[model samples]
Target chain A: MAELSEDRIAAYAASRLPGARDVAVSGLARISGGASRETYRLRLRYVDADGRSVERPLILRRDPPASLIETERHIEFAAYRAFHGSPVPVPQMLWLEEDPAHLDYPFFVAEELTGFESSPGALTGEAYDPVREKLGRRKWTILGEISRADPEALGLTTVMAKVAPEDCWRRELDYWEGVLDEDEVTPQPIIRAAIRWLRANPPPPAQKISVVHGDFRTGNFLYDAAGEIHGILDWEMAHLGDPLEDLGWGLNRIWCWGQNDLRGGLLPRDQAIAVWEQASGLKADPAALHWWELFNCVKGQGIWVSGAKAWSDGETRDPILIISAWRMFNPQDRAALELMGRL
Target chain B: MKPDPDAVLGYLAGLMVQTIAPQVQPQYLAGVIGMSGMLLGMAAQEWDRAADRLVKENRAIRGLFRQAERVGLDADLAQEVRALAGGQDDDLRISALESVNTGLRAALISLHAAVETRTDAASRALNDAIWAELSASTSRRAYTGSPF
Candidate 1:
């Protein structure tokens, strides 16, 4: 529990609701296993203007003292708004409070879509065995729908800085490589070598400056036994950039959590791409996809190293950070090596 | 040797995390204590075999570096290889062995890269050796919870 107690949350809710009374919050328990944000599930009960009692389940995602990836809450809120009620399902975001007075740090509240498993290992279990293909189709198809969305029309361009098609690769590469340079505790010769190679062979200008769901992959979505994806979560890294960037990220080998060539612990890599291509009506140019694939390895390594640095520096004290850093570092390096054709 | 130090450390770590940390206050301290538990767990896994793994890997890297020198290589890289190959872990401390290992690995990467660009059969064979050493090095460092 944070300094802001359940009473404070209820008080805040009462103020937001014009005719509500006796606004109370209960069942305020923190959900385990989020390194970037502290997630809590609570129930909000209040008497409405009609004198009817209403209850709603809500989730609070508060910014941690330090995070694995620094991201904007507003961008995630805007991304939710952009996808809600569309083919790409997302929880409806209610409030984004940037004021530290409310909570020591920025936070956002959204509808809690319960009754679904989101773990990467869950998808590989026997319970989901029958619906694997269906889930796979929905996963990539929703990504295709995201790729199909217009950033300008969705008002994302105003929030996500627009990048030139050719500059997209450079901007993303530079940013992630910068993270690696800043956070690396040890020499990463493999990643350093890959960075050099990426610079030597930059991808072609993006086919379209589509919205890139920066961390779009397995374990980032809510799914059930019926092969339905309820909500796309973790849009904190959402931005407008090369669409192929998302495709490449999805195709990264690390997301092959099932330990197969298939991506996202779901469908085969080519099949997943096929679904995306068919839905978005875009060709995944081989050379461009290859560059982005290798670039993602660099990006992944950057994220893992940053996790290690965050733990080492004592900026954040979360077990997930330690778990992430130790588990992902060497694998990320190996992925980079494989991408650079060294393995 | 009867009750392995590694097993005892791991048991103590489990006790600290599962039995003790939760009872503490100031959530931040609990997290620190939890991480200390993890460090202990990792240390327990590493403690007993650290010297053995380092010794084996140092010997392996030295042999590879010597093989690299036998190949007709660029003079500067060959000298670098010769210098690394001639070195030994004089100080038996884990930190000292680690320092020497880091130096050898860095040299290995350079040698591997050098041989990667060459067309000679000896360069190719040396490249294979370097890759094997790199693979072995990762395996040696791999922990129980590693994703790979």
Candidate 2:
């Protein structure tokens, strides 16, 4: 199959905007590092239904041939649409295309949250030096808003599977462990140990179930120098589970960006938790949070191992997979060890 | 071999990321080129150390099995550990060494778990030793660019 052409995208946009004329898609450049989707930024220009000239910048996320995580695009679209204009800032979802005949893959187009940096490496630099604390506060606080959100209220319950608070931990653990089982090309002794430990000791039921931003980490969000979080991206992993799961994932040591002391390379672990606690108006419950944090190590490893398996098996040759495997495998183990109090 | 393999990889990686990636059209492919370069960089680092790291780690894990035998693990686990403790990575090929390493590490997990169960002082000491070895194992496999 041929790669998707920009003209085809413009034609699809024209079809969607029935009354719009001269629908053109330009600047369709693919952004790197989205292992789960083919993300592209494009400039869309057209004359609207009112014969009004309009120019807009948009992001197009289309499904790839095979990806690390399999998720429902509709769910992601719904999650973004649900969060639009809410406390959790997300790009306005414009159109969701499930029929592949137009673009050759299921994709969604949304208004791009432009002019912001999303690189984790940039966060470690001197540029974000001034507002690191403020950014950290905003990061977890927004997570708090997401955790405090009601799926039913947000019309997300229909798309995201409903999970009871008590079973949240088990459900997530089983899913990731199963992935490790099928996808692990190498024996992950540390992950296997972590899994047994997780099963042996499970976190308490969630305080209250909230919308879990399945991949809520510093790199997933749009941050500016003034310490503002414009958008919380990557809802492909969005689900309803223990809110602590998201909190733990953010606090996962693998995200420390080589600075083990600074969780997510933004704030100290305790400080990040405190900011989250204050914003969520909930307790971190040291023991339960610790369990979730360790569990996230296993989850993190599962993702990396799967990426390795995918690349090795020739399913996809995305260098990101090799990077994830080579770059993350050890850090994940170290993180697990630290969480287990063995480090 | 006159030009060091690592140096060659480093040069290629630099060109790919600095020159090729920037000049590539359609940002996604550019990004792939950039990351491929980075992957090459990491591959270079791992290539030189792969054999030494695997040999040292396999030896360390085998030594741990010897300690597990002294601590007196479960009958079945002890038997397995004892057999592995006397084993050798005679085949020094990376693939062969990795195969042995995988089995040894698997047995180590079993030994570690069994040691955790016993309340004996030796078991406690052995358990701690296993953790130390495990920590060392991760450090051996460490990629400089790892986030954690």
lDDT of 1: 0.83
Q: What residue runs in model 1 are displaced by over 4 Å at the alpha carbon? A: B5-49, B56-86, B103-132, B142-146
How closely does chain A match the true chain A in each prediction, as TM-score?
Answer: 0.97, 0.98
lDDT of each: 0.83, 0.88
lDDT of 2 by residue, A81-132 (tens): 9999999999899999999888889999999988999988888999888999
How close to the true structure is residue A167 of candidate 1, measured as C-alpha lDDT?
Answer: 98
**The 10-residue segment with the lowest total lDDT in model 2 chain A:** A25-34
How would you encode candidate 2's per-residue C-alpha lDDT over B69-141 as one tens digit per residue? 6775558887988898898878889999999988998887777777776788998898788888888888888
